[model samples]
Target: METLRQYRENLQKIYGKNDYWMVPIFRSLFSMTFLFFLSRYLQMTGKLGNPMVILSLGLLSFFLPFSFVPCLSGIFLLYYFYTQSILLLGVGALFFVFIFIIQSSVRGKYAILIAAMPLCFFFRIPYFLPLLMGLTMGLSAVISLDLGILVYYFLRYIREYKDKFSTGGDLVEQLDAFSGNLAPFIKNKELFLVLLLFTLAALAIFVIRNFSFNYSFETALAIGLCLESTAFILYPAVGMKMNLTGELLSFLLSAVLSIVALFFWHDADYRGTEFVQFEDDAYYYHVKAVPKKKA
Candidate 1:
């Protein structure tokens, strides 16, 4: 435990010392990954799919505000969609505008977390996201989580309909394609489950960990995993086909990853001997005492 704490402290110190350069490099890598995956998945590598251009954009992301990544990504997506379907591009544009509005409201504190939701979905470790957020965040993060889910589903809609959309077709055909892609939220059982499992579970875990009790974080984390496991049984009800063995293996992996994350991010937050209490409109807050970081 002593060795682990020292390691955590050293990692924190390293980050603090290097974050000036480190932040951009990490963001740049993420930008490149995002663009590459989008292009690869679409199987449409035009100028936007050029490796050199992607690298240049990554470098630019390092220099400019990270917001530039999403803007470029959005414009690129809209233009791509425009080639496929103008009405579809219009829908993407609206989503883009709404995201910017929400981004401004949240001050982008959880932007990385939110942006990572789809990536998590792609990597099949989406179960890790809510628990990590619940461990470190407050209710304000709900917006970020919701936005992330929105982006995930929006991209899914694009993928599902891309083959069906008309680049130049009769108005009736375009409308038909657009309307089908705009499937009702209630019809998407997975969406409902995600809200219940990830969003609500995270909020519940947040509340549980903040309670005045022993081992609250552990309890909360355990319960979060339990909730996740319960979701497997719900797959059939949600109209989702399941591969039981594969899912079981994924659960084990997600559980291990979640625990590791808890260690690296949460447990490292060692506390001093003081307890503090504060409150907001919705709930009271109990802050664990800790030595302040060095100046």
Candidate 2:
């Protein structure tokens, strides 16, 4: 525990010193990574998908606010959809407009979860979403995460159906068939399972972490991972096939990583905790303060 606390202090010192350049460098890498995955997922090896082009665009992203990365991703997505069909591109446009409306309204913290969702899904390490978002960003992060998951599955199902639907049929008929098929996809057990598990687990962790108690964050992470693991373990009973052993192993790995993240992001000294009471002209206040550990 002391080692972890010391490491976090050293990390903060380094970040404080280099943040001016480090943030942009990290942002560039994140943008490039997102585009790289976008290329592979969309199977675009053209100019837009070129590594040099991706690197250039990523460098440009360093000058833009981090929020711009999502717009950048959407533009890339829309272009990919354009390569597929004019109609498809229109659908993607409307989808982005809808997402923009919601994202603008809430304007939650850790907006990058919108991108992280698809990225983690692609990497098959989605088990960390609940604990990561809940512990770090609280319940509001779940909204962004939900959007990301929807984008991932939406793109996934659309790609699977694109070839089947784009057989040069009547335009209206194709649209009708596309919208019609979405029902079953919407009802997909896998989609619902992801939504349910992530929502509940994140919410649970958010609530637990807010409690004023010793080891609240650690307890929250443990319980959240247990809940998530249990849900995945019972997927077979729900008639959804999954590799039980593989899922368990993934959960275990995610749990270890979540612990590491929690230690760095949230650690306190209960021994240094203080309770105080003060009376002002208006009212009296009772306070409990737990100081975060530092080197």
Which of the numbered candidates is closest to the native, going by highest TM-score?
2
Best by lDDT: 2
Compute the lDDT for candidate 2. 0.82
lDDT of 1 by residue, 33-144 (tens): 8877777767656777788887887777888766577676777688788877777777788888898788778856577655677777777777788887888787777777
Model 1, residue 73: displacement in angstroms? 2.3
Model 2 CA deviation exceeding 4 Å by range: 165-170
lDDT of 2 by residue, 1-295 (tens): 6776787888989999999999989989999999999888867768877899899989998997678888889988888788777778887898888877777766645567788888887777788876798888855678888888878887888767776456477778878878888776768888888888888889989999999888888888888987887776668878888877877777777787788888778877888999999999999999988998876
In model 2, the clashing pairs are none
Please report the TM-score between candidate 1 and the true structure.
0.84
The residue-level lDDT of candidate 2 at 36 comes to 94
The deviation in Å at residue 257 for candidate 2 is 1.7
